[model samples]
Target: MNLSRPLLLASNSPRRKELLAGLGLEFKIRVKEVNEDFPEHLKRAEVAEYLASHKADAYQHDLQNEILLTADTIVCLGERILNKPANYEEAFEMLSALSGTSHEVITGVCVLIKEQKAVFHDITKVFFKKLTKTEIDYYIRNFQPFDKAGAYGIQEWIGMIGIERIEGSYFNVVGLPVQKLYTQLKALGLIS
Candidate 1:
């Protein structure tokens, strides 16, 4: 099986790299400056998916018969969308809102190769147990979850202690919907 077409990952996320590596497929990474902004009319899930596809559009020139994968994840609660934290106060606020509450984690995936393009989004409903002020403070002070959406990592200590339940793909919360991704990759002939 000489299934190779030069897979390229258009992201700078470590979690995305880890998840893709789990598929046992070799890939190279490249990123371009693409505007993450989306139209204000778009809602929660749409925001993530739209940005994902738009982000991949920056690498259209690099397609060259090679598949390019790009993704974006966001934590949405109520009408608010929580992206990566810009500062400690915002991170604290995001965590505080998420405590003892259920929120949706939406991850949007874009796979493109030449004229073929596929885009999809997955949603995971995660319920966090009532987190204490001290617990939140500890996680914020120690772990410094500035790079993760919603100021938390589902695979981290807060998730270990605070996550009560989840509905939908667990990997989605971790950043990539691996099973769905496998299906899409297979359908798109990106993998064997």
Candidate 2:
């Protein structure tokens, strides 16, 4: 596809990088350190979008002709937000909470082209079958899900066995809503 400007991906996530690359879109990785903190009032999906926009804001001055992309994903179970696990115990707790229950996986995407910017989000409902302590422990020990939200990756072994069903884009649960992002990019004339 022909693009009007260079594409810049402002993230260090390997999942996001792989997803963008799967779209056959050429982009350069340009990450900037940004605090992921959000307002205490923000809830569920709002938190993801706010953080994504915040990440984009860090490169506001650096955007010349490049279209910058930033994204954030969060796992929500009821009113609580399950962020990346800080340790093995946290991972276990997060997974245990999600076991045999339906939860929302929200991913917010930000596309910025100079002064013009578009921020949107996609939510996927994921249902997991009851997970035993042994299953959770084995998965954690083998996969070491310290870098993933909700203490798991939908593309991993836990997802394959534990996930009972899902409603909405699976890619969103993985990280980047590639289809929505592609459509948005094309609509913005960033890619053809």
Candidate 3:
């Protein structure tokens, strides 16, 4: 991919940074403070897309022909949205709820180039083997995934052993859907 303008990533997530870098695209990181609060009526994918667009909108005033990227990931089981856990106990509870069940990992991405903007999302269905309390405790103690949505990282130890299978883009679970992002960038004429 080629770009005429510099790429700006407006997220603090290392996973997103790593995934984007893997595509061999050079970008500058610019963290923006935005409230992730969404309307109560939004569910699943809508929540992520809304938050991602909200993050991108923060840079609207300062954008200058730069391609800005922003994304949000959410884990959904049934109708419940499992956001980043605030505490260890919440982490344990969220994992326990996910044990031996299938959940959806939705990653919403927004690409902004001046006045042109595109918002899209990818959903990956992940199945976890029944996790033991000891395993969950060990993972929590060792990884301390408090900053990650769903209290877990798909590229971490827990994902290696706990996740039985996934039905969609694996990178989406990690944080960013690179394939989708690349396609979107090409469609937007930001890349070739």
Q: TM per model?
A: 0.96, 0.98, 0.98
Candidate 1 minimal-lDDT segment of 10 residues: 1-10
Which pairs clash in the backbone of model 2?
A: none
Ranking by lDDT: 2, 3, 1
Q: Kindly provide the TM-score of model 2 when superposed on the true structure, using C-alpha atoms.
A: 0.98
Candidate 1 positional error at 186, Å: 1.0
- Give the clashing pairs for model 3: none
Candidate 2 has its poorest 10 consecutive residues by lDDT at 183-192
| Candidate 2 per-residue lDDT over residues 1-192, each given as its tens digit | 767888999999999999988888889999988999999999788899999999999999988989999999999999999999999999999999999999999999999988698999999999999999999999999999999999999999999999999999999999999999989988897776
- Tens-digit per-residue lDDT, 104-187, candidate 1: 999999988897889999999999988888999999998999999999999999999999999999999999998898888887
Steric clash pairs (candidate 1) = none
Question: Taking the candidates one at a time, how many backbone clashes does each contain?
Answer: 0, 0, 0
Q: Which regions of candidate 1 deviate over 4 angstroms?
A: 1-4
**Candidate 3 stretches greater than 4 Å from native:** none
User: What lDDT does candidate 3 reach at residue 145?
Assistant: 96
Off by over 4 Å in 2: none
